[model samples]
Target: MPSLPATLLAFLSILSLVFGGKVLVFPLDGSHWVNMKVLIEELHTRGHNVTVLRASNSWYIKKESPFYTSITVYNSGGIEKELFEEFSRNILVIRRQKRSFWTKLKLVSEVGAVFEEMHRNQLNLMGNIFENKDLMDSLQTAKYDLLLTDPAVGGGFFLAYRLGLPLVLNVRWTMHGEAHFEIAPSPLSYIPVPGLELTDKMTFVQRVQNILVYMFSKFQKARTVSKHYRSFCEKYFGSEINYKAILQDADIWLMRNDFTFEFPRPTMPNIVYMGGFQCKPSKPLPDDLEEFVKSSGDHGLIVMSLGTLFTHLPEDITEEIAAAFAGLPQKIIWRHTGPRPVNIGDNTLLVDWLPQNDLLGHAKTKVFITHGGTNGIQEAIYHGVPILGLPLVFDQPDNLSRMKVRGTAKLLDIAELNRTMFLEALKEVLYNPSYKENIQRLSKVHHDQPMKPLDRAMFWIEFVMRNKGASHLRTQSFRMSWIEYHSIDVILTLLMILVLFCVLIYSIVKCICLKVVLKKKVKTQ
Candidate 1:
């Protein structure tokens, strides 16, 4: 039987593979990109069809996330974990900021942009959702086993839900309590109280952090903030919209953050920890750049990059930055998008963009001065280089502040702070062996994780496909009541009990009054 009909058997095997195999890998890229494209490139090698359907039409990501950019993955576990621990150590900073009325007003004014991003998914957020949906439609021409997407856009998750396919939401930053709301006694989603900052406790500040992260990473609030988005999606799909489809359709959710950084995993499954997904030492830099960095010699080289987005710094900030670097003996390589200062000093070099990961990986590099992007932080850790985080806005300050507390980086408020103070901070990092030592320790912890995050994520994706879309991994919380999910029902029950007790007391008083009236009448008669 086996010898007969060789063509028939060959056809049957091929048919089986076609009917049940093949994965449509979707790397839904967008503007203001990170190393996600690099992840997509690597994952495509697994004999799966890969399509990068997300558009980076925006100025920010288009320039940063080129299809041909070189990428390297670092395995620095020690420094990463150490940095996270350092963040835990400084819980009191964001915690005890007991604001006066005036201070609260000022704080609100300072953080106004952040608050706006939170409640309303304004700016380019609407455009992003539409683009993501278009990409899914294009990909849907063929069936996909699962969708691997960042949690920001959320359209991919909706696609998976509609197609009845398994999906994974890669968490780019900490997004706490977005899943539930009736926060009683705690903001944490069940993480133990003691390990709040380090591993488990949400506390109020962390909860706020969670909100900030989600808002800044492309606003997801389509109803109020993005009525245009809701209407557009409705027009296109002809259905009631899913406000939280981003977190809901995820059969598996991969967090780019780790337990070392935030509260520990609390009752969430099909969740994989791959926080340092982009943390790694990449390929070597060009010889010229290496030689330039090496030429700094005894003074050492300082990398001053404003990262991709905020490179368009104000002239005031630029002049201050130049003045500050002028004081330091160390040579500064500022990642600038504007004109270099007239009569540029011998010790400073300004470039529109430098190969960041490559420079960080180099030995000649002394310290990193960056805008506190997560990818940059991971790269610095991988290289075991200390940082001087000059965070501008968004999650930059928070990320940098975490690093600063970890003893790897010192924060400098470059916007308003003068040049003298900036120079002093740089000097401290340059002369500080403690910063280097701490970073080295953290580097080890960051890499010492149980498994390579990317591989783990790839395995889950494959597992879902092989299991014919393991939808069971998705949580029932997707359909659960806000009261049940947030546990507000319990609070309501307590309120009801209190009300009953009050009613019982009132009834007892009324009964006593009636009795008194009856007794008085009888005595008089």
Candidate 2:
């Protein structure tokens, strides 16, 4: 028989396997729920205790779902609806406005106000949640092992910092903005800002514009948003914690992007690319969807959506799209909202929602008509579907720009869209074998990994928990100031030395010339 100590040790090991580490996740964007959902579910399946703190009015994050334990942190019922409505209106104005730099800037300023309001509301919501001493005490007693948050919402980082837990950021979009640059090196000379739509190969003027815009955005955020956020942290946490330092101290950054889809840029060792982590093999479609797809026969199918936010398009734009689809032989499956267009096509199927990924994975899915959201693009890429992009706003244009460069997609400005343009773009993507060929080639690269993206993300998450924050993987640059990180001080010191040397050489030359002149005068005399 085994020794009692050895048997006890074996039983403890089994217990450890049965009860994994506890994880707390705060997902910011409702649209981003899909990205975090898979990781959260997988962790729960692997015996980890996962708790998701979600807004009560979230479009996703069902409380009844048994996937994980969900705690409602905020209960602002109408705020989200009002914010989305205002956002939709702003988008309409932007789409109708003349395309000019000033016009775009003006629209962005107007939209900025809406976002500012949303931020303030979110802060208030967070404040309400934190003020509940009972809930706070309960959470504190639970003693979570780590915190995974989407920092885009602005409150998650502060909460994580307050809890004194290992922080892991889930950036569901491509890394950009001030917080992203503070941790990773994003050179303005090449890597485009998320909304700017510029590619890696920027012209001289483009580079200058990019740098100016980047600087202006950082300055604006510091001036306007930073103070409010700082005050919130101080008010709730009862300490003046430097949020930037907290961000830098983060254990891991799980980005929803791949280098194949994005421009090459410097990434820290702790930054892991978990792109397509939510993607999976197509499940059997719902009966109606399966029948609708089968109705296409050999004509093939096109799937169109503007994702969760922009599904309610303007009437004229909707009419234009419907008309365009009406002319096409291929059957159309559009996920749309609002009143149906006047000219609804016979071949088109309009539903409030559809299983997008499953439809994309279908054999008949020839092309994806999308707003170029990262998740949607990743899904299309995973299924090897060519894209006809109608880029709406923020990062959509940039995503499509990359796809256009890759020859896997074509872009159309939603502001300038017409039936003819839409039809031409759609036909080109459908008829051109190059788009399909390119996407297929890239899909192989996307799938050619040692482990699946979800597995990789889970491994890193567990690794952080096991090692208590993977501090060794953190880059030394995170501790450096911006000037020091860029070596500006070194460059300035070298320039000063070079200038001093030049001045000394000039003084020596002047003395030599004068002495030579005096000698010549004496010799002549």
Best by lDDT: 2
Q: Report the poorest 10 consecutive residues by lDDT, candidate 2.
A: 172-181
Q: Write the per-residue lDDT of candidate 2 for residues 68-138, one digit (tens) a residue.
A: 88888666633566677677778777767778988778766765666566567667767876888888788
Model 1 residue 300 lDDT? Answer: 79
Model 2, global lDDT: 0.82
**Residue-wise lDDT of candidate 1 within 1-525, one digit each (tens)?**
555689787876666445443443333232224556655555554545444433333322233333322211121211222442343223213222453556434443444433333323322333344456554465566676666655443344444555667766666532222222211123434442221122243567776655554454334332233454355456655556644544455666666666444433454666666766775666777787777887888877888786554564556657776887877777778887777765356788888879887777777788998877777887787678899876654456656666766778888654346677777888899897999999988888878877877788777766777786556666676577768977799989999999999999999999999999999999999
In candidate 2, list every pair of residues with a backbone clash: none
Q: Best by TM-score, which number?
A: 2
Could you tell me how far off, in angstroms, the CA of residue 138 lies in candidate 2 after the best superposition? 1.8
lDDT of 2 at 265: 83
The alpha-carbon deviation from the true structure for residue 155 of candidate 1, after best TM-score superposition, in angstroms, is: 2.4
lDDT of 2 at 263: 79
Which ranges of candidate 2 are over 4 A from the true structure? Answer: 1-19, 74-78, 172-179, 236-240, 488-525
RMSD of 2: 4.7
What is the alpha-carbon RMSD of candidate 1 to the true structure? 10.8
